[model samples]
Target: MMELGPKPRRRTPTVWVGPVPIGSDHPVVVQSMTNTDTADAEATAAQVIELARAGSEVVRITVNREEAAAAVPRIVERVRAAGYATPLVGDFHYNGHVLLTRYPECARALDKYRINPGNVGARQKDRNFAQIIEVALKYEKPVRIGVNWGSLDQDLLTELMDANARRPDPRSAREVLLEAMVESALRSARFAEELGMPHDRIILSAKVSEVQDLIAVYRTLAARCDYPLHLGLTEAGMGMKGIVASTAGLAVLLQEGIGDTIRISLTPTPGGDRAEEVRVAQQILQSLGLRTFLPQVSSCPGCGRTTSTFFQEMARDVQAYIQRRLPEWRRRYPGVETLKVAVMGCVVNGPGESRHADIGISLPGTFEEPTAPVFIDGEKYTTLRGDDIVPRFLQILEDYVARRFGRDGDGKRAAAPAGREAAAPTRRGEEDAGGVAAGSAARSEAGRPGRPAAGTPAGSAGGRAAGT
Candidate 1:
């Protein structure tokens, strides 16, 4: 198979947020900010734990006021006592310098401090920025020089605007803003290094709401510095629009190998799930083949043949089941997140696709017999009908998990399961008893003994199978 997707990651200076490493050959990190009021230490700490459980490597909480800053140490203590070692980041804007100075405990408690250079004010911009850096240097903590387009440094923006006007054809306001964003981040990083902070202790981010603008700013920053870049599309609106926009922006940069750590800034609706942001980030990374956090449910978009919503309902249930059981499963089955389960509908491409999954089920469609075939390791294992289809398939799935990953009598996990190629047995030109067949071409391409042929279904060639 040919190499695809992201180019090799650009080299960047490594920075550690607690024990987790960012940049320079390490896996891309997923992070998120808590929406809870930081002044309420207990609530903030609880949400932090929740985000950590949802796979956020680092959790950020706003430290905008003295009360919030004062609560930091308590929040940190609670999270640590609860057995989560995930790093907590302090997101500071206008008053960070003062809060970090007056509340030394807050400075000590946080693993990292994020300073937005844009809102640090024009008259005391340098002084305020320097104060924040001094505290970070004193604590020996990593600092992210975050520059937001909305709260950009007015002084730098004004200067860039002036310079643009001198050109024969003046640049647009957007171009000037982009330049200012990059300039603000680089200048802040350089200043921190000058103040005796090591380059590796610094991370950088320049966020803009527009997808194209966000990409442009990060690409410029990546070219100019080796600092680890934090990727985000700030102020992306709520619901599907936010998810799509954030994914589009982050995916483009990630594929080009530009980001180190990422957070999806989605505006949650009233009483919405905060952990949804973390899931979105995980899905984006997993979809791009960058990381795996949970077992994936591959389901198909129902067409005319699938008249009933049985497959759709089954897909949702399977996904929910995986999510609910994932935490326990992780402790019990070390690599279960890599398991792929397909729940395909109809006979058109169902069996061919089902054979590619580790475990899969193909349910009957309209005008067809009401039976479902379950395949394990690319071979037809059993068939089911009536009300037991879901339960039977789930049982087989659980059994497969236990057999493949359950611990031995000695309390240690069993040997790692074989790869798909080894598990898939070659049938030559024979069809299974269920009227389902695995193509000879698929078997041959899988490096088994068979002849090559064309017209294989989408998920049949030893790849991710279609589900639902």
Candidate 2:
């Protein structure tokens, strides 16, 4: 474990969710949950093993009741036994602390517990908070206080309704919803403090299904408090839309320095791996420069300028190839987070985009110089045509992965050398970890709903929700 400075006071992060530090200037975290039934030890352990291999910094699984809690120790042990120490977080809903207290073994097994602030019943709120805190305190595990508007406290909702009885505006509902989450979270943390827990022992969030609402509440909380925030778009759907929506919202908050950790929740597909959720989240954070993962791929969206379908196919093929061979990559490259490969559709933008990548291929049309341009370490090394693309591209990437990233056995940081900003990573939505100098400006240009494409893309932090 790397030794860090003595933890600070108020701004100090509550708990380190994983092995890595993830608060108060620490790199943003990327995490996901297991799709395997928590009750099924063999199936769940198998899923955890796969997730660990996929570069998931943290793995969460629902521990809805006692049966699920009983499975925690076995699953967690299986993860460690598999030789990967990916931090496990027990996702608890109602009566969570009861399970933790009854099965103290769970407290000893997992690294963190994600508690939904909105669901714990008011009548049992204090008891629930204390029970969970007791478990966390016993193990020194960090807690993520997650709040979703969809599952808001019934009592708080009623109180909010009563408070707005005189001049009720619909906006009041949103405001109350956001405020209620923050207030409930603060209340829970206060209990932790009263119970003698340290300040850096927790993370907080007010996640929502709506992007605007999620961004709004988080921004509000960050401005007022200093707790490390966990960002997510709860129940974010699947496919490109789910990934984009979650990224868009999270990117906005992350750029502004609001989120300490994040997850991109995708709808689980039948027979589909849920761990991919963590990978996609990692890619988003890495692309935005918030976290690191498998080498960053700067593949292009093919257009009329594209020479052949080869470039597009090459991109998919290389990714698949890497996926199949990750064990070897990790074994060989030691500390390489990703392979830093780029596959551009055309030479026009490809060449420039390829510069930041470790290995790159820029497909070209009939050219004066070469049929295709390939760059290694930013130098035009060779030209390949026709069927030569895939093999040559893979060769360059492998060389870059080996030389820059080193073999998997050697301990080295494959991340690019840091620049001036290591002094202080900017607040959310300002600059992504990608160091792309251009973020919201590019997003503004990408086009918004009714807004002009003449403007830049809406930031990942989120614009003013969908309304204002």
Candidate 3:
């Protein structure tokens, strides 16, 4: 990836969720919550591993009932036994104090405890909140005092509202509500500190669903607290709306350096992939130039000048190619995630954009040539044509990845020089740690998501029952 200038981060005290660090000094963390019933440890642990493999640095599961609490140890055990270091966070509400106390092993198994002050028992709110804090203190685990709009503490809102009502110039009800959300998190955090929880052991989040409200609430919270913050637009719906709303809301706060970690709350369809949330969160960070998790494909939306069918098909094929190769590529190529590949549909801006990417392919536009020009390091390496375009291009891509990012014979990683072509490198079979040859690897991958039409074509969990 080209250097997209990084924004100055907001400074905060660091909080660790297992081995991952959350603070301005650390890269913004990507996290996702599971929709699986926590009582089913096997299913939940499987999804946890899936989310972690998909790039969730931390995975949170709802621990709403005794069964769920009882399964915590097993879930943690399974996740660790599978060789994933991804931190597991237990989301608690209502009977959290009881669950944490009765199930000491569960409390100890979790990397962190998420407390929703809104539903921690209104009558015994402070007492119950203190109990969980004590458990966290005992286990030396971090706590996220996560506040959501739907679950803002009514007592705090009413208190703030009544106080505002008495003032000569009262604030709007919405303003008071947002204020209450912030207060709920901050007040709980302060009370936890008073109860012996270290200041650094606490994380704060005041989340609202609306993009504008989320921005306003977080801007205020960021100003008032020095604790690391978990950022998200709670209940961001499903599909395109969810993705856009989350990206919009998060991008703003992230650009301002407000969030320490992020989770995308997308309602997955039944039997849908829960790992989608993790991928989205990673993309948000990658898109903002804050972090790089996978190679990004830049493809133009087909215009009148482009052959819609062929062009669109190539774009989809290219993206699918990158995704399929990611697992192996990541293991073999240390910095391969920073690779940028562009699949342009036409000549107008295609070559220009292709030249800017680490590797790119400019497919001929309508009435142009029958060939696709492939670029590597800003130079035209070759022009691909015939039915072999996809395979050939993928071959070039894998070779570049192996040569530029893969380790050499001595096992030290090699890098392509900036602004110039690099010396001829050992072929993929020679240098690859896995010893997989470039030709065979590309052929296998291209065969899986093979492109048809030689010419052209086209192509989180959160919320109230528990804390997000």
**After TM-score superposition, what is the CA distance of residue 145 in candidate 1 from its true location, in Å?**
0.3
Cα lDDT tens digits for candidate 3, 336-396: 7788999999899999999999999999888887888888888887777777677667767
Superposing all C-alpha atoms, what RMSD in Å does each candidate have to the true structure?
12.4, 13.3, 10.8
Which run of 10 residues does model 3 get worst, by summed lDDT? 458-467
lDDT of each: 0.78, 0.66, 0.78
Write one digit per residue (lDDT tens) for candidate 1, span 294-397: 67888889999998999999888777766555555655665677889999999988887788988888999999899988888888887777775665566667
Preferred candidate (lDDT higher): 1 or 2: 1
Query: Candidate 2's C-alpha lDDT?
Result: 0.66
- List residue ranges in candidate 3 displaced over 4 A: 1-6, 409-468
Work out the TM-score per prediction: 0.86, 0.77, 0.86
Could you arrange the candidates by TM-score from highest to lowest? Answer: 3, 1, 2
Clashes in each model (backbone N, CA, C under 3 Å)? 5, 46, 12
Model 2 vs. true fold: TM: 0.77
